[model samples]
Target: MMLIKRIAVALALWFTAGMTPLKAETTLLFNVFVPRSNNFHEVTAQWAEEVKAATNGEVTIQFTAGNMAPPPEQLEAVKSGVFDIAFIANIFLKNKAPLLQATMLPWLVDKSENASIALWRVYKKHIEPKAPFPDAHLLTLFHWEGGQLASITDTKINDIKELKSRKMWALPGPPADLLKTLGMSPVATPAVQVGEMVSRKIVSGYMGIAPEIARDFKAGPYTKTITWFPRSVTSTSFSVFMNQEKWNTLSDKNKEAIMSVSGEHFAAMAGAASNKEMQAALDEMKKNGVEIVPANPDFYKKMQAAAQPQFDAMRKEGERLGVNVDAMLEDFIKESESIK
Candidate 1:
C-alpha cells in the first residue's frame, strides 16, 4: 500500500507540472512624429497589435508620440537603450548614416512607396548589420508621401523663379538643403512651431505634405495658398528599431514572427498609410479653400537637371566607401519602376 501511494503522489506532481502555464513577456517603447490618431500612429499601432496577437500576448508595446524629443536625438536614444523602439527620419540621422543620404537625395525617387521598398531591400541586403545601426535591429523603413508647398504669408508663387529668395519655414534636414538649392531662404523651425511662426509672419510659406499642415500644424489663420510644388519629394525613411540586447534575448521563433511582419513588409504598410493621409489631407485642404499649384513641365525639368549632379556625387562617395552606389541607385530605380 505504501508503494501504491508513492506512485500516485508522483503522478499527481507530474500532472500539475504539465498543466502549468509558461508566461513570456516583452515590453517595447515606441515613439512617433505625431499624436495617437495620426496616420503614422495608425501604422505603428497596427504593426504592434499584429505582433502581439501573433505572439499570443507574449509581446507588449507602449507608445509615445509627437516631437516630444528632438528628431535627431531619436536614433542615439534608441542606441543607448533609453527606448526599445523609435521612429526616426533617415535625414535626421544623416550624421551617423551618410550613405542613407544617398537615398534622400533630391528628386531621386518618384514615389514614396517605391523608394521605401527599394531602400529597405538595400538596407537589409547590405547596410544595417554593418555599423551605424549595429546596436539596434531595424524593424521597418518607410517614406512619407506627396510633399507640397503651402503658404500662410504669401498667396502665390507661380514658378521656381518666384520661389527664389522667399522666406519659408523649412522642415529641416534635406528639405532645407533642397529648398536652398531652389534659391529659397529656409527659416529653420520645428513642425510644432509652424503655426505660431506663420501667425507671427516669420515665414512666407511652409513646405510639407497637406496632412502635416492641416492636422498636425492646424495651418489656417497664418496661411493662404497651398502650392503643389512637389519639389524634392519629402518622403522620410523611418524605422522602428529594437534594442539589440532585447532583440537578441527574444526566442528565435519570436524573432522570426516579428521579422515576418517587419522590414519590407512593414515599409509597405507605412507607405500606404502616408499616401492615404496625403490624399485625405489634400481633399481636406481643398474644402478649406487652400490653393493647390502644380509644377509646370519646365519647372519639373529644371529641378531634375539640378539634382543629377548631387546624385552623381553621392555615387562617388559610395565608391569610396566600397559600396556600389551606382548599382544601388540603378536597382532602386529599376525596382521602383517595377513596383507599379
Candidate 2:
C-alpha cells in the first residue's frame, strides 16, 4: 500500500511537470521614429496587436515612440540589438540596398496598395536571395500613395518649359535628380523642413510627397495648386525589420505567427491605411480652397520622356547589383496593375 501511494504521487508530479509551459512569454521592443499620428506608426501598433493574437499571447510588442536614433541610424540600432524592430526608410539604405532603389523610380506605380504588394513580391522573387539586410530579418516593404506636384503659385504647370530654372523642393535621390534634369533648381531637403522652407519662400513649390504629408507638415496652406500625375513623379519605400538575434529567439510557431501577418499582408494594410489618409487629406485641402488639377497631357508626355534617363540609371545600377532589373521591373508593373 505504501509503495503504490508513492508511485502514484511520483506519476502525478511527473505529469504536472511535463504539462507546465516550456517557454516564457516574449516581448519585443519596437522603436518608432515617425510621429505616433503617422499612418505607418498607427499600422505598426495594429500589427503588434495582431501578432500577439496570432501567437496566442506567446509573443507581444511594446512601442517606444519618438526617435531612438536618427532616421539614418535606425537600421544600425536594430543590427546592434538596441531595438528589436524598426521601420526604416529605404532612402537611408541607399548604399546597402541598391536593388531596392527600383521602387523609387518615377511613374512606375499608380496606387499605393498595389505598389506595396508588388514591392514585396519583387523583393522575394529577386532581391531576397541577394540578402540585402543580412543582419536584420525583413518583415515587409511598403510605399505611400503616389506623390503630386504642389506649388505656391496659382498657375498650373501646363508646359514643361515653365519648370526651367524654377526653384522647387524635391525629395532626395531620383526625384531630386529628375527635377534637376528638367532645369529646376531643386532643393533636396528633408520632409520635416518643407513647411519652414515653404513659409520662408525658400522654394516656389515641392514634389514627391503625398497629400497627407503636405497637410501634416503645414505646407498645404501656402500651396495654390496640386498637379496630380497619372502615376507619381516618385514614391518612397519603407521596410519593417527585426533584429536577427531577437528573431532567432522566437520559437518556430511564434515566428510563423509573426510572419503570417507580415509580408504582403502587412504591406497591403499599411498601403490601404495610407490611401484612406491621403483621400481625407485631399478632401480637406479642397475644403481649404486648394485647387487639385491633373497634369496637362502634353506636359505629362514630356515628363515621361525626361524620366527615361532615371529608368535607365536604375536599370544600370540594378544590373551592377546582379539583379535581373528588366524582368523585375516588368514583374513589378504587371503585379501592380493586376492587383486592381
Candidate 3:
C-alpha cells in the first residue's frame, strides 16, 4: 500500500511539473571594440541595466569577453550573429551610410549638441529612408563632436592657414577629404597608429574628440596645444546595431524595452555624456599648461567661407546617394540654427 502511494505521488508531481509553464528568458551578446572604459561602453552598460529592468529580467545583455575586437570586424560579427550587437564607426564602412556623411561637412555647427540634433533630424527625414543598413537594425546613432586640433607644438591654432602643408592624421571619408581640401597632408592611419605616427613625426597632430587625449592614444602629454574649433569640422558618426535576425526573434515588448533607450532619446544622452568627457579633458589640458585656443568669431566666419568646398563636395555625394542634398542641407542648417 505504501509503494502504491509513493508511485501515485511521483506521478502527480511529474504531471504538475509538466503542466506548469517555464519562465521565459532571452540573452543577447554585445561586442565592443574599444576599452571597457570607453564612454559608449558606459552608456551600453547603463542601457543593459535599464533594459533588463524594463524587461523585468526577461532579457539579459552579455558583453563579449576581453577588451579587444577590431572595430573593423564589429559590424560583420553582429551580421554573422557571432555577436548580437555592436558599435559601427560609420567611417570604416564608406558609402555604407553615404547620405549620412552629410553631417561630416566641415563647419556644420559650433556645438556638438546642435550638430547631432540636426543630423538626427536630417537622418530620420532623409537618410534613414535610404534603408542604410539592410543587415541590421539600427538602434541609435551618435557622433563624437567638437573635434579639436591637438598639436605637438606649444602654439595656438589661430589661423586655418597655419595647418596648410602640415601632416594631419585623419580618419577616412569626410575628415580626410576636408583635411586634403584645407591643404593639410592627410595621412589615413588607424586610431591605434596615431601616437606612433606622432612620435615618428609623420603627422604633426590629429583632430579627434577630446577624450582620445587620455583614452585611446594617451595623446595629452604629447600634445602641446589644443584648439577648439567653432563651427567645428565634421563629427565622426557611429551606430549601435543589432543583428536583424536576433531583433526579429524578440517580442514587441522586449524590442520596446531595448529601443526605448535609443534613437533620438539616446542621441541626447550620448551627446551629454560626450560633453562631460570633453570638459574633463579641457580641465586637464589647462592643468598641463597646454595652449588652449577657442574659436575667434571673426576667424570662424572666415573658416566657414573656406569650408565651402567641403560643403559642396558632400552635397554632391548626398545627391548621388538619392537624397535631395540641397534641400537636406537647408533643413539641417535651419535645425542647427534653431538649436543654437
Predicted model with the maximum lDDT: 2
Select the stronger candidate by TM-score from 1 and 3.
3
lDDT of 1 at 73: 78
Can you write out model 2's per-residue Cα lDDT over 209-321, one digit (the tens) per residue? 88898999889899888988899988888898999988998999999999999999999998888889999999999998999888889988888888888788878887777
Cα displacement (angstroms), candidate 1, residue 296, comes to: 0.9
The most accurate candidate by TM-score is: 2
The reply for model 1, stretches above 4 Å from the true place, is 1-23, 31-33, 62-70, 126-132, 152-155, 182-184, 208-211, 220-223, 229-232
CA-lDDT, candidates in order: 0.71, 0.87, 0.72
**Candidate 1 residues 1-340, lDDT tens each?**
9999999999999998889577879988886756567777777788989889777788888886445466777777777877778878776765566677777665656567777888888776556544345457778877777456666654476567766647877676556666777666788676677777777777777775445554567665455776654434455667668878888989898888888888888888888777777777767767877766776778767766655666777777777667777777677767777897
TM-score of 2: 0.92
Tens-digit lDDT track of model 3 for 209-232 = 454443457666677876677555
Give the distance in Å from residue 7's predicted Cα in candidate 2 to where it truly belongs. 16
Candidate 3 Cα errors over 4 Å, as ranges: 1-20, 67-69, 165-167, 203-205, 208-211, 333-340
